[model samples]
Target: MYLNQHEIKSLLNKSFDNFVDFVNTLPDIRFTASPYGKWSAGQQLDHLTKSIRPISSALGFPKVTLRYFGISQRPSRSFDQLVTDYQRVLNGGFKTTRAYMPGVIYPSQRPALLQNFLLQKNKLTVKLLGWSEKDLDKYRLPHPLLGKITVREMLYYIAHHNEHHLAKLKDQELQGYTWQNQLQQLIF
Candidate 1:
């Protein structure tokens, strides 16, 4: 529920580490293969890197500048609540915005993508540690899908978001399952 910076950091590290380990082990062909025209593992990694870069950059800004977004009026949501909200949105057919989408990621880019993701993740961890627990709950950041959420909630979302993509990548059954097929099945 209430995760202090250290706890949040640990969760973030574990999720990211697990996701990276799984992805790194995939063969070049597997990494580049876009199952059913969806994102390939490399594309997912690229998307993740794109998603995290901004959070780390934003956190480095002075607290005064962050106030431009204002503070949270209510308490931060628990991790489960945030995940549930995210899942509900996903189920409702929420698609990622253009800025967060990944381009065609080549297998050759895996190492660089991993390196960049680690850099962004580490910066985020450091920035998070720089804040007090109270400040974490007090400050707000605008998330495209979740709207304005507290810093803590954002961390929770990051952790779960990494796991979410990891699960998708790991699902062998997803290889041939396309959204269009799912929709066609529903139509008939």
Candidate 2:
């Protein structure tokens, strides 16, 4: 589906709101528990937070380092590291949370994490509202697994990724399976 600025912004806002609502309903125990064996609630939050860092950085302002290094040649970095770096940048005033991903760090101080996640999501919605069609077309960064992709593509993938996780989270909630229990079932 093609999206103009207004449409994109609307989608972003709605998605952000939906995410906040979902998180708000989650009990603290669930937030800390891993739905699956591989990732804790905290780790998933870290992963989502990491995923958006490059996209926001690429789109919000051009980085001379990126230009100089080129997309393909940029240093290999772990997603977790990038997320942490983005957080640091936010704290330092180099970037705002508004441009970051829309999820809270799992197992964090619940109130603050939720507050920050919602705040950042709102900021990102505003940023999306300001984007031009041309901006969407611009290549943001290279994915470690998928190679180069545009801002629009990244946005689509981000939504899909969130949906995938949300589905899993829902399953965990409905089944009432803890991380260890899920692992035990898989082993059997």
Candidate 3:
């Protein structure tokens, strides 16, 4: 669906708010814990950080690649690793591009890795708001996994991804509480 700037901004704001709420609900320790064997909290945050990079780039000025991650082989790097690597690079004023081709790796990480995920998310939201409809369409990018996604699709995926993770985190929280209650009754 094609979203006007206002609609995109609203969705981005809401999505970011939901992500913040989800993060707040977690215990500090859980920030380092992997909800599943596959991904840690830090990794998830890192993923979010990297996810916004393309949007940020698109919003900054006119570019060939819009609404999608750049046309690079770096898809092999998980968003988490890229965040960690990029965080360091960003700190030093040195930007690094992905070294490999797209679709080569499964991205994963712990939450502690991305301290500014929410902030970056907000920046991206603002960026989306400034985009013209034509720019959004012109920069239609393809996802290695999803394939040929428009800018609107990319925005939807951002919110959808956050929601998917939030649900997983909530499930983990509920399961922990249930387990704790069961253990308490047994101990008592």
TM-score to true structure, per model: 0.91, 0.63, 0.62
Error of 1 at 16 (Å): 0.8
CA error at residue 64 for candidate 2, angstroms: 7.5
Q: Model 3's lDDT to the true fold?
A: 0.55
Q: What Cα-based lDDT does every candidate model obtain?
A: 0.86, 0.54, 0.55
Give the worst 10-residue stretch by lDDT in candidate 3. Answer: 99-108
Candidate 1's C-alpha runs over 4 A off are 173-188
Q: Which stretches of candidate 2 lie over 4 Å from their true place?
A: 36-38, 63-108, 177-188
Candidate ordering by lDDT (highest first): 1, 3, 2
lDDT of 3 by residue, 1-188 (tens): 44566776776678667866776665555554543353444445556666666655656665553424443332223333423443454467642235211121222332333446766776777767676665555555654444555565566666666665566666766665566535643553
Q: For residues 1-188, write the lDDT of model 1, one tens digit per residue.
A: 77888999999999989989998788776687776677888988899988988888988999989898898799988888999999998999989999999998887899999999888889988888789999888999899988989989999999999999999988843543567545644553
The number of clashing residue pairs in model 1 is 0
Give lDDT tens digits, candidate 2, residues 28-67: 6667665455454444555555565555555566544445
TM-score of 3: 0.62
Report each candidate's C-alpha RMSD, comma-separated, in the order given: 5.4, 10.5, 11.5
